[model samples]
Target: MNSLADPRVADLLARLHDEADAQRRLIRDRVASLADEAPGPEAWPHHMKDFYLPVSREQGRFLYQTVRATGARQVVEFGSSFGVSTIYLAAGLRDNGHGVVTGSEVVGEKAETARTNLAAAGLDGHVEIRTGDARTTLADPGGLVDLLLLDGGPGLYLDILQLLMPRLRVGAVVIADNITDSGAEPHPYARWVRDPDNGFVSNSITLKGGTEYSVWIGLP
Candidate 1:
């Protein structure tokens, strides 16, 4: 909500700010200490999508860590921006010995850049970058997705849900980022999934902007 001035919102923001700052320092230190050939040039590239609001590398790492903690083997992402998150996810997958990430990007350029970045990160083989509307691409994804990330257009959030609902495997974790409306109630996706019929246990966390985390409960 735009009522970021509210004490609750302010407190949440402060916590996020502190956490983000700590994460940035950690990422910097990790990157700095890495051997020149450790990550390698093929580990992650520089070209990002135009709309890519790069997440704090730490946030990316955290997401990856969460996925790894869940022991997720297959992941799907609604938006692939510059492959920053892709790199993080791929790193976790690599560490897990066997995993894969499939990301969708509507913009061709963004998809291309994502591919390059994944290749740079030595993750191209572990990640698949799809160029098209995510809703459609996910409609018939070949495998059960264990984890999902939503960072595409806000208005399309519900559409993505409808498309992915039937495909989501039980126990899957869905993370939706950027769910704010400045004084408005929760976003449409949050509202819709809150309905009992949707079969999702949902909660909002005020992370960077706002993040809605949901898990499927009912059988598809």
Candidate 2:
């Protein structure tokens, strides 16, 4: 029942993860160069266009399991760079027998590349990659979202969450990446979701890039 174990998916994941590892130095250098001007999040897509910035194999597996466990029919992913994570999400849907992972990527080239990669994994049928700003591309998911993955620009995490909240089914899962505890303060997204007043019960878990797992409880 694990579509991720399929040879096509397993092989592609290995290659993508290896590629991401090789780009570590370039990513670090790019971030360091931005230390001076402190460019806004909008500048990140351009700077990171060429990088894989993929989720770790563990994180991808977690995503797959979450989808299967939840029986999620509608999943949305923000920041599907090159679709490494998208492949995992889509694989989950395929194994579940029905569902779709709607992904957004601002970089047009990355979106196309992601589509190709998904096809290579034999998962293109379970995903839709929308190439444009998530705010616009993800405006209407066409149905209630059963799960949402926030792996895009940190600054836009809250914005995108708010935008999609209305369409998120009660008890829906929300997984945010890069929510590390390296900072003295809790990340804004984590803070918002952890507050019961915000209608979510959330907790941060030790996983690749630090994962914030939350469930929508609806307003009290």
Candidate 3:
């Protein structure tokens, strides 16, 4: 017995798979390089809750490209899990002459690890590591955010969204990671961003689970 599907569908699936694999390979290479330069095990104590799920190097490159393309000079991130994403954001900011990527990590150890990692990546100067709950840290961010990455607590996403909206620039970009889990959409963030009144044009792409990209449309 043979179970063959439509030729076109199969072809499309193959193409997508191939693309995904290529992206994975790229991300792997980047992560490996980062690992080589990362601080020793002594820095582990400062990390936040072991939520150090690093983004693929390809994803990091994609993020950097997005930030550079936007010409954003100020960036803010809600979670600095070992500074993996922070390095990527800082790389982009570095290329744009002068910019800062401020990140908050609730755990002191994790924040310290992030600091060490960013420093090893030669990005410490371009990135600021804040050790505390993101809610409190964001409450008084001293800069305008042209780009925001939400990788902190998904439960606090709505609250973070509300808090950061006012500080975002007119054409700011917000990227949220981990939107779905095992085929179940677990976070309300995507829904909130999709709401019409939110003034955010958002969509989810199936990359490393699922990532939501939302473009803020300024205040109403």
Cα-based lDDT for every prediction: 0.70, 0.92, 0.73
TM-score of 3: 0.74
Tens-place lDDT per residue, model 3, 46-65, is 43244455665556666788
- Quote the RMSD, in angstroms, for model 3: 12.6
TM-score list, all predictions = 0.73, 0.96, 0.74
> What is the per-residue lDDT of model 2 for residues 76-129, given as tens digits with 9 covering 90 to 100?
999999999999999999988999999999999999999999999999999999
Error of 1 at 153 (Å): 1.2
Q: Which lDDT tens digits does candidate 1 get at residues 1-220?
A: 1222345433533444455455665566555655544653323222222335555544665677767788888888877866767777776776677788888887788789788767755667789888877877777766787888887756677888778777788878888878764676767778877666788888887676777888888743
RMSD of each: 13.3, 1.3, 12.6
Looking at candidate 1, what is the lDDT of residue 114?
80
Question: How would the candidate models be sorted by lDDT, starting from the highest?
Answer: 2, 3, 1
Query: Which portions of model 1 show Cα errors greater than 4 Å?
Result: 1-49, 181-184
Better of 2 and 3 by lDDT: 2
Best by TM-score: 2
- Candidate that would win on lDDT: 2
